[model samples]
Target: MSRRHVPAVLALVAGALVAVPAQAAHAATVQVPCSVPDLVKAINTANGTPRADTIRLARGCTYKLRAPDPVNPGNGLPVITSEITIDGRGATIERDGQGGEVPRFRIIYVDKTGVLKLIRTTIRGGYATDCPAFPDAVGASCGGGISNNGKMRITHSKFTGNTSASPVFAQGGGIDSPGSAKSTISDTEVSGNHVVYTGQEPESGAAGGGISNDGPLTITDSKLSGNTATVTPDTRSTAFGAGIISFFGTTIKNTVISGNRAFAEKGTARAAVSNGIPADSGRLTVIGGAVRDNVSDAPGGVAQGGGIANNALMTVKGVKISGNRAVAKDGIARGGGVRVGPSGTLDLKESRITGNTVEAPGGTAQGAGIDNPDGGVLRAERNEILRNTATAENGTAQGGGLYHAAGLPASGTSTLKRNTITDNRAADGGGIFRASGGLTLNGDVVRENRPNNCAPTGTVPGCTG
Candidate 1:
């Protein structure tokens, strides 16, 4: 009787072992349902898994994150802490409230140990304000939609209607990366995002209306448009990079930056895309892109760099800079298309700089096309500069096409080679203006500018008025 019982129990145990091994040998793809609770559970499981996981969201479904996570108060979803890839499959994940709005939390947050890959999703209406746990700005909040302190990869996605809502300091309305983050974005759309400050606090401003990265970032074949960085009230700070801003090691290739704005109600406004502010040592390289229809307006303060502004090293090649404007009502407006700071070096080649304007009806405006304000080194080669305008009502407008100001201690240098500067209009120096700097021209065509070509009749050598 005992021998028979032993054999029966052993047979049952052997069956259980074989069944467990069969199931563990082949894992199925984890797919989350359209329900919010299911999605939350799926992400929680993925974060706890040791191996990298890919979770496919319900097709074309909208996952509404109605409330912040209980563990992390500022995040709408679970904090990603492992290698996870969320394949949206045309679905959308948004922070849901009153139109996904008003003091909202972020959609996704990646911790330092996490790696996130987002594909084919749309992240909408995420707002980050007073987020102390964020890696950058500490208490000031950063990254309305997605924030990464680890690594992130985004492809074929969209980030829209997000805001980083601190007036004191903030960064990245659409996406943000702190100093420890590394990201690669490809074929994405980041639009209609904002970083706005309306308080009258002195030096209250923010950076990067669409996306901001303080670490290594590479963006390719993407579109960044309709983003804004606006600072209202009587503040004296500066709002920088309405489209995108990076501190260091950023490269943008084959992207489009258009219809972005930097508006300062009382402070200074920078351009659509900023490599780095003057205080940083960031470097940017832009290739085969278009920067167009951007604006920098500061009626009560200065406006600099309507399109692309650089205070660090920048290399731009095969790009188009067009239809950008810099406006200052009672102050100075400089650089309608591009502005290079004194510590900056710009190497622009084979680009088209056209139809840019510096409009200061009640102030002074300078450099309709490109302005390198005397401490920067600029080299323009084989480019077309055409039909730009520099106009000022209170002061004389100068440099319709390109402006090189007086040299500083660093002594800025300008070299124009095989460039065609034509059809530009200004009060003085319609073609190219060299107030004082090292100017070397070789095979450049400076002609047909309105008012005159080269102000003071002899400022630019090898050019006749």
Candidate 2:
């Protein structure tokens, strides 16, 4: 009962405290049921904590949102404001009203302060009708399945059957991330999404039927297919980027973007994969990807760039662009495979552009394979442009393989080396069409075109018959 006893007791107490361990900041895992309310509750609980939390959904179960919030209509769940991960375990979180009367709302909304990671999830059946009402400020309507204003990572996920139906303006039918938001999508599938606007006169239209990113976005091992961006009834509105629209540039690797359609009933329809549509400051890089079988059709207006439309600095390497169609009713149709717009530069290497077609009923069709028009610069190396068709039923068809039209002086230049341009079909300049551009073709083969090979009807420099 002396000082020795006190020391022994203190040691015992310290040992007991160390053995019990202080409350560690362990990540909490909340298992959720198949109810949307329960999932919301779990997310709210996770938001209260500081550490990263995971909400795991019941395997194979579907959590459907029946109605929008009465106070904040068109919002399905509580806004995510903290770092949280939703592990769907191959389950689905969808909007309930498929055929019944249901309010339009996105499935998930990530606020500016949120960091969301979705894994093995399926987000579907969302309809975003109005956007200014929401906090993301992407447009009038955007992000049908998920609207993200913060950082997000989606892995092994699927976004399907979502629609952005803003009558005036819309973007990102499946997922929309605007402003400074950053997102990475890997091993994902974004399919069957649509962006549609059916308003009249000066009402503008939609873009990115699968995904729209105004911020930095990177996608790897992903597939974007069967998406549509349409503007109907109103001929003044336009449509673009049925698979994806990246305004702030996007990096894609080992991806496939196919079977997408951008159609305008009266206005302009452009691009299955639209890069840098909003501005020219962005850059697009595609490595080992395939963009094929897409359609850009303006049955009553103009259509351009059926496969890829680049309006910024674009670099494409080891890519395949084939079987895309750009069809117009009475206006010009151009660039069935790839189009570089004004002030844009396209650096293509080891790529193939084959079997693309541009058709116009009464207007001109140009550059069925690659179109670099109006101050666009193209640098090609070791590429193949083969068997493309530019058909104008009652008008002129030019440059079935490559169309290089430098609109302004010293604005457009095409530098081609070690490229194959062959067997293209057009009324004139079946292989290469050069109109007022600085064309330098070094070690290139231009031959066997249906008509002549080069424009001006002669053996151009660095090209053969």
Worst 10 residues of 2 by lDDT: 10-19
**TM-score (C-alpha, index-matched) for candidate 1:** 0.91
Residue 17 in model 1: lDDT: 9
lDDT: worst 10-residue window of model 1: 11-20
State the lDDT of candidate 2 residue by residue for 209-315, as single tens digits: 99977667799999999999998654556788899877666799999999999988668888898765334336778899899999999876778799988777789
Q: Rate the local accuracy (lDDT) of all candidates.
A: 0.81, 0.81
Off by more than 4 A, model 2 = 1-25, 70-72, 132-139, 179-181, 277-281, 408-410
lDDT of 1 by residue, 426-463 (tens): 98889887888788789999999988888767777899
Each prediction's TM-score against the native? 0.91, 0.91
Show pairs that collide, candidate 2: 131-140
